[model samples]
Target: MKHINREVGSLLTRIIEKREKFLRAGDHKDDLLGLLLKSNLNEVEVNKNSDGGMSMADVIEECKLFYFAGQETTANLLTWTMIVLSMHNEWQERAREEVLQVFGNNKPDYDDLNRF
Candidate 1:
């Protein structure tokens, strides 16, 4: 939680500053970070120092959600996969061999992951 708090806080701070520069110049785009980036990105449209944008408290809570949700989903998947593999080494090795045959120990591509 601490690590998530620090990382998200820093990222959000930088994003907010960048958003300010854009807004001041009347720039707009569909960048995901365009609105969500700034702490006051939306608020600044009418009120420069308004607190109408996502609040620090909300951002902090969101960071907790991201960390918990992301970690739990991925960790559960990996743990279950590893358990299944350990219970069936032969099947696991066959799958591994097929993977090596296709990718040959190199990094995978988006296409390959999509297929998997």
Candidate 2:
């Protein structure tokens, strides 16, 4: 258990370091991490828990949780979608057409996500 915790701690450290490096490099993208870092709150301010903000540690843990949960959910979704599509190629083609209509070979944005 201690080894596992140590490994997780190391992973979080690496993630934080990489994010800090990116910030130092001025590679600011408009994402969740960008928004959080832009807030310019210290770990102490975040830990105050007064405005639904999170500490650095909490952000790291949330990122780890989101990564694992999103991975599992996406895998399951693709698996089931493939199984169903194999049984219904027509529906699969229709689905593809609809997606093409919605996205037009471009990346979907937040507004597009809500259309579904």
Candidate 3:
């Protein structure tokens, strides 16, 4: 388990570094990863002045937790939603129409989700 954790941690560290670089070069987008990157920068500044801030490891751990937990939950929800939609085609069509109406071809933002 310890070895597995170390492997995962190493992978996550590389991922975070790459993401930081992408964030620096890419256009701004409001999303969870973007928000976390902002938080990580703030935490770094805070840690420079005091010891009461999150470390890089802590931020990495949080990113890992969010990735795993959020991915699992979203996957489960999508699986169940697909199952339910399959069982009820009428509702599925309705949902598809609603999504198209709300978001068209673009991804839904927070306001769109709330309205949906």
Candidate 4:
């Protein structure tokens, strides 16, 4: 578990560093990391006399929380979906047919997902 935590921290640090480079170059994105960095910069600017903004570690921790939360939500969604499908054969068949019709023996495309 300690090794895993170190690995995750290292990865998040690398990601944050790369985003910081882009941010410094004026290539600001509206994504989560970008927004966090922007907010941190704003806070620092506002509180030039004190340490009032999130540190790199704090940003990484926030990212970790969001990452885990998203995974949990996705897992719960899939679990519930499977349970519902198992209980409703007709709905499951319809869903299967729709998927097959939309993507038969091929990888699904993002544009075609709206058809479902």
Candidate 5:
């Protein structure tokens, strides 16, 4: 697990490094770190739990988890998709056509995913 974790970490770092290279070329942000940050919830509602509001620290940790989980899942899905397509070229073509038809605008909505 450690070896596999290290390999994944290394690859992710490389991916981010490459993305940063493009930004260095011309991109700039008012808050570079802010651009990398996101919250899973817009706001915390008041509950019986004290003053009620997602603590900033908790928000940050959750964001890290969300980012890592999303990245890893996406990576695995793409890898498997490629392997499956290679092993079944006929099915691959059909899948491509369906995807194109549903998301012909190049943007897929939640509804489109359900069709899959």
Candidate 6:
């Protein structure tokens, strides 16, 4: 567990570092990390005389929480969807048809997923 935690922490640190670089370069994104960094930057600016903003560790922790939470949510959604589809053949067929129609043997992209 400690090893896994260390690995995840290292990955998050690298991601944060890259995002910070982009932020400093004025190429800001509107994603969660970007927003958090922007907010932290603003807070630091506002409280230049004091330590008022989140540290790099704090940002990494927030990202970790969001990352795990999103994974859990997606897992739960897929599990329940499978269970329901197993119980309802009609709905399952409809869903399969929709997927085929939307994807057509190709990997589904974000925009195509929305249509599905």
Best by TM-score: 4
- The residue-by-residue lDDT of candidate 1 on 1-116, one tens digit each, is 88976887788667656665886698865554454544355565667555556665565566557667989999999999999999999989998999999889789989888887
RMSD, every candidate, angstroms: 5.2, 7.2, 6.7, 2.4, 11.4, 2.4
The TM-score between candidate 6 and the true structure equals 0.85
**Across residues 1-116, which tens digit of lDDT does each residue of candidate 2 receive?**
88987798688878766876787687766776666664544443566756555656777777778778989999999999999999999999999999998889899988988886
| Best candidate, lDDT | 4
In Å, residue 59's CA in model 6 sits off its true spot by: 0.9
Q: Candidate 4 residues 43-94, lDDT tens each?
A: 9889999998998899989999999999999999999999999999999999
Candidate 2 wrong stretches, greater than 4 Å: 21-27, 40-53, 92-116
Mind giving the per-residue lDDT tens digits that candidate 5 earns over 14-62?
6545544554565544443324421112123335445554554544445
lDDT values for all models: 0.72, 0.76, 0.80, 0.92, 0.60, 0.91
Deviation in Å, model 6, residue 28 alpha carbon: 0.1
TM-score of every candidate relative to the true structure: 0.52, 0.53, 0.56, 0.88, 0.41, 0.85
Better structure of 2 and 6 per lDDT: 6
| Residue 14's lDDT in candidate 1 | 70
Pairs clashing in candidate 4? none
Tell how far residue 98 is off in model 5, in angstroms. 3.1
- Runs of candidate 5 exceeding 4 Å displacement: 1-54, 99-116
Give residue 43's lDDT in candidate 6 (0 to 100). Answer: 94
Ranking by TM-score: 4, 6, 3, 2, 1, 5
Candidate 6 on 1-116: residue-level lDDT in tens?
A: 99998899999999989988988889999998999998998899899999999998898889989999999999999999999999999999998998888778999888877866
In the predicted model 3, the residue pairs found to clash are none
The Cα RMSD of model 3 versus the native structure comes to: 6.7
lDDT of 1: 0.72
* Predicted structure 5: clash tally: 0
